[model samples]
Target: MIDFLTAGLVLGCSAGFSPGPLLMLVISETLTHGTRSGVRVALSPIITDFPIIAATLLLLMNLSGYHGILGGLSLAGGLFVLYTGYHSLTARPVQLDLPKEPPKSLRKGVLTNLLSPHPYLFWITVGAPLLTRSLKVGPAAFVAFIGSFYLCLVGAKIVLALAVGRSRAFMGSRAYLWIMRLLGALLTFFALLLFREGLKLLGVG
Candidate 1:
C-alpha cells in the first residue's frame, strides 16, 4: 500500500514538474490570464483522464494473466520513464516568452490534454498495469494509488500556476532545478525496477 502510494506520488510529481506541453500551457495561461485560468488548466487531467483510465483498465484487465505481454509493456514503460527522467535531469529553466492567447483556460486545457500522447502512453504502459495489480491487492490499494496520483499531479500544476501568476521567477529558480534533478534520479531508480520486473516476467536475465 505504502509502496503504491509512493510510486503514485513520485510519478505524479515527475509528470507535473516535467517539461511538457501541459506544463507550458499551465505557465503560459497563468502568465497571460491569471491564477484562476491556470488552475483551470491544471485541473484538466482530472477531466481528461477518466475515459483513458477506463479504456486502459479494460484492456489490461483482460490480459492480466499474460505475463509475457505484461513483461513487454513493463519494459516499454521503463524506457519511457527513463526518458522522462533524463528530460527532467537536463530540463531547462521555464521560458516565459509565451505568446498571448484568448482566455479559454479550461477549454484549451481539456483539448490539449486530450490531444497529448503522454497521458495515453502513461496509462497504457505504466498506469493501467499498476492499477490492475492494485485491484488484485484490494480496493484500498487501488484508491491509494489513483488518489495520490491525481492529488499530487493536479496539485503540483495548480501550485505552479499560482507561483507563476505571482512571481514568474519561480519557474526559473534554482530550487526548481534541484527538485527536478532529485525527481529524475528517483525516476531512474523506478525505471531499473521496471526493467527487472519485465525481465522476470519474460523469464530472462
Candidate 2:
C-alpha cells in the first residue's frame, strides 16, 4: 500500500514535470491570460483521464483470468517506464515558445489531453494492472494510489504555472534538469518493482 502511494507520487510528479503538449498549453495560457487560466489547463487531466482509466480498468478486469497475458503486459509496462526514465534523465531543457492563438484555456486543455495518446497508452498498459492489483488489496489502497497520483500531478503543474507566471526564465534553469534526473531515478526504481511483480506473476521470479 505504501509502495503504491510512493510509486503514484513519483510517477505523477514525473509526468507533471515532463514536457508535453499539455504543459506547453499551460505555459502559453499562463503567459497570455493568468494563473487561473493555467490552473484550468492543469485540471484538464482530471477531466479527461477518468473515462480513459475506467475503460482501461474495465478491459483489464475482463482479462483477469489470463495471468500470463497480464504478466506480459506488466513486463512491457515496466520496460516502457524504464525507457521513459532513461529518456527523461537525458532530456534537455524545455524551450517554451508561446503560441499567438487566442486563449480558450479550458476547452483547449481538454481537447489537448483527450487527443493525446500518452494518457490512453499509460492507462491501458501501466495504470490498469497496477490499479487492479491495488483494488484487490483494498478500496483504500486504490484510492490512496489515485489520490496521491493526481494530487502530485496537478500540484506540480500548478506550481510550474505559478512559477512561470512570475518569471519566464526559470523553466530553462539547472533546477529543472536536477528535478528531471531525480524523478528519472525514482521512476527507474519503480520500474524495477513492477518488473519483479511481473516476474512473480509469471512464476519465474
The list of candidate 1 runs beyond 4 A from truth reads: none
lDDT of 2 by residue, 84-187 (tens): 89977987878888777777898999999999988987887788888998989999889888998899889989999998999887688899889989998988
* 32-69 per-residue lDDT for model 1 (tens digits): 88899999999999999999999999999999889999
Model 2 per-residue lDDT at 17: 90
**Poorest 10 consecutive residues by lDDT, candidate 2:** 1-10
| Each candidate: RMSD | 1.3, 1.2
Worst 10 residues of 1 by lDDT: 1-10
TM-scores of all predicted structures: 0.97, 0.96
The 0-to-1 C-alpha lDDT of every candidate, in the order given, reads: 0.91, 0.88
